[model samples]
Each structure stands twice: as structure tokens, then as C-alpha cells.
Target: MKSKTVLITGGSSGIGKAIGIYLTTKGYNVYGTTRNIAKYPNFNDFKLVQMDVRNAQSIKDCIDEVLTNEVRLDVVINNAGVGITGPLEETPSEEIVNAFDTNFSGPLNVIKAVLPIMRKQQKGLIINITSIAGYMGLPYRGIYSATKGALEIITESLRMETKSFGINITCLAPGDFATNIASGRYHAPVIKNSPYEKVYGDTLKAIDKDVDNGGNPIQVAKKVHGIIEAKNPKIHYKVGTFFQKFSIILKRVLPDNWYEKLLMNYSSK
Candidate 1:
């Protein structure tokens, strides 16, 4: 296969960074974007640029920079996102908006910016890094699920619409990995005397523990490379452990009440 140019957002750390490095090793020219370059600077072996997916101008600027030298963008990984945990009632409006803006609209901005180029070139791949939470609503992480589920629907539509143009769009829904996502997660007011304190504390601790024991970030990167090389990749890729991916099927097959109970039990444990 010919060499390709790849652009990955939020590539400074975690899965994005891992994908960039893995792709570079395979001979693809890679440009990884991050808002904070100083902290990451360079991650092993990918070129770094400053780009915030939530900002249209920043997205345009980064794509323009990549196009300048690379001539064409062969792949785009929409990996920039944020995590928020709070009861829907207590989660601030601003926090909700920010979650949607960063996790959902951010990918839309990048996709819109790059679509023209890819359509003209007649071939490209767009991967939106979503999460398994998107498949179902988890209590405190409802907003996060909404954002990812929204992206999945959008990506499905895009795949159908862009089929003839050779633009391949896929959603990479990962379960959990030991990334810094937990450290920087958004929090709603879980102050003393709040009714949700005990539950919130318990759920958050459980979530973090699951992530700590989750698969390595590099595993996702390897799957990304497979998606890149496949002539006909699927519309969605699940990068997680056996049971986590299986839960998607379980959700569809199980009775509604049963599934809800499962989520209640699983998330709170």
C-alpha cells in the first residue's frame, strides 16, 4: 500500500498518542494535535500540533497545517473528548454543554473541516473514538453516554452518505483503559449533605477501579492500524475486553427492565 497521511486529535496522550506512534512505525506520516503541547511536546514519534476540536478555527488551522506538507489527509481520528460524572438533576447546564461540545460537536467540527478535502481526494477514513457507555445510559454518566450515542448515530448516517465518495467513517467504542481520563473528569456538586454523596462516591470509585484494571491503551492503537489497512472496515469497532463488548449484545437482547437492573448493579458495584 502507498504511504498515507494521518491526523489524530487529542494525540498528546492515551489512545490517540498510541495510535499516532503505531501508525508512524508503519510508515504513515502522522500529525497529532493537542491543545497543550508543552506537557506532551512529543510522544515517542509523532509530529505535534495545537488544535482544539471544539473550535472551528482551530480545527481548520490544524487541517490546513497538515495539508500544507502532507498534500492529502488519508485518515482522521476524532479522539478528543471529556468525561463528566454527576446526577442529571445536579449536573450544571454549562457542564452538559461542555460535554456535548467537546465530545460530540468537536468531532462534527473536525469532520466538516476535512470532508471537502477527502471527498475531492476520493478516499479517506474517519474514526470517532466513542465509548461503550454510548450503547446504554449509565446513571451519573448519562451526559457522556448521550454525547457518544449522538456521535454514533451521526457517524452511521455519515457512513451511508459518504459511501460512494470512498470516505470510510467508523466509531471506535472502547470500554476502559488506564488513561488520565479519570483524573480530569468533570464533577457535579457532590458536597456534604447532598443526597447523592454516598452513591456518587461509591460509583466514582468503582468506575475508576474498572478503568485501572482495563485493557492497555496500546491495544486500541493496534486495532486502529487494522482499521486503517482493511479495504472494507466495519461501521463500528469495539476495543475492549470480552464481557464489555458482549454487553452491547446483551443490552439489545435482554428485557428492558432486566438491562436497567444490570446497569444499576454493574455501575454501582
Candidate 2:
């Protein structure tokens, strides 16, 4: 059997890199994309290509390069996203646009670029990396949550639309993971006299700590491998700790006000 070719966006580091390396070891041909290929002069775990997810042309060129070398594009992981944290009121409009462009539209661009190739093959899989935060409107992270939540909802519709074409689409929402996302995320500065200053400051610290103490990203990588091997994958899969996954369930069962209170209480911690 020919090895499956996998393309992962933002595959240079964090969960993306972990997934690429793990799949490579599992006998899959993995091609990871980075905005700047020059940064990873030593990235040999898999094929690294240049791509800016925000740029459709870049995505096309990267996919073209991959198709040039491989016969079939088996899997596409839309894992390229940026982290944005701040009170929606305080975050700059431009920054908010950037966040949405990178986290939301970026994945759409990659999907559009690959769907044609996948449709021609008559069998393909697309896994979207969402977030547990997306299940709710997280304090100081509302925009980030909205972006992922939108993708999650979009995945549902996309799955049905492409099912007839032998294409599979699913979302994998992971909780906080120990990664370098903090260094790259856009953070709205806490103002000296602003109303949300104190609480926002505290929440920022907590968010950072959560990432610092979060679970190993390799766990997510393992989950991705399982999803790939499954015969019929579900529309939604979550990779996170007990509490993180449970939080989503709580929202579904608890009263709206109660769930809001629960989130507030948890964020205060």
C-alpha cells in the first residue's frame, strides 16, 4: 500500500510539529507548512514548505508543491492558527481582524485549495484543530473562542456538503496545551485606569499559567492518528483533560445563567 500523504499547516512547531513527526514515524508521508521556510533550516522530520495561511496564493503554491512530489493528498490538517487574548472592548480593530484572518479565514483558504484535489481522488480527510475555549465565550478570550467556535459550526455544515464526494471533515478541539503560543499571541495591554484592568490582568496570568501547566501536545498527535485510521470519523472530537472536556458537557446540561456563573468562577481562579 502506498503511504498516505499528510499536509499540516503551521507544522513548524507546537502541536502541528508534533503531529507531523508522529505521523512520519507511523509510515505516513507528512508535509508541514511554515510561513517562513528559512526559519527551519534544520527541519528534517518531514517535508517543510513555505506557506502563509492568510494568503490563498501561498496556500495554493504550497499544495501545488506537495502534489508535485506525491500522487495523492490523503489528509489535510488545518492547524495553523494564532492566539489572541484581550477584552474585546480593548483589543484593536486591526488586531481583531488579524486574529480572525489567521485563525478563521486562514483555514478556509487551505480547505478551498485542497478540496479540489481531494475530490478528484474520491477519498480524503480534513481535520480542523479547534479549542475547548471555543465551546464557550471565555473571558479575555472571547474573540479567540468565537473564531474556533465558528470553525466548529462550519465543520458540521461542511461535512454534510462533502459527504457525497467521499470527503470527510471533522473538528478536534484541544484544551490548553504546553506550547509557545503565548510568545506569538496578540495581547491587548491592560490599561492603568481601565475598568477591566485588574480582572483582566489576573485572567491573563491564569491563562499563561494554564498553558505552562497544560498537557503534552503529543496526546493531541496521538488522537489525530486515531482519527485518521477510523473508518467513519465523527464531526467533533475533543482532546483535553477531564475537567476541560467536562466543561463542555456542563454547558449543555446546566442552565445558561448557571453555566455563565461557572465560567466566571473558574476564570476568577
Overall lDDT per candidate, in order of appearance: 0.90, 0.95
Per residue, candidate 1 scores C-alpha lDDT tens digits across 1-269 of 56899999988887788889888998989999998777874355779998998899988988888888877899999999999999998899999999999999999999999999999999999999999999999989899999999999999999999989989999899999988888778978676878998898889888889878878898999999999999999998898988999999999899999999998988777
Worst ten in a row by lDDT for model 1: 36-45
Pick out the ten consecutive residues of candidate 2 with the lowest summed lDDT: 55-64
TM-score of each: 0.96, 0.99
TM-score of 1: 0.96
The prediction achieving the highest lDDT against the true structure is: 2
- What is candidate 2's lDDT per residue for 143-238, written digit by digit as tens? 999999999999999999999999999999999999999999999999999999999999999999999999999999999999999999999999
Task: Give residue 80's error in model 2 in angstroms.
Answer: 0.4
Q: Per-prediction count of colliding residue pairs?
A: 0, 0
lDDT comparing candidate 2 with the true structure: 0.95
Candidate 1 segments exceeding 4 Å error:
42-44
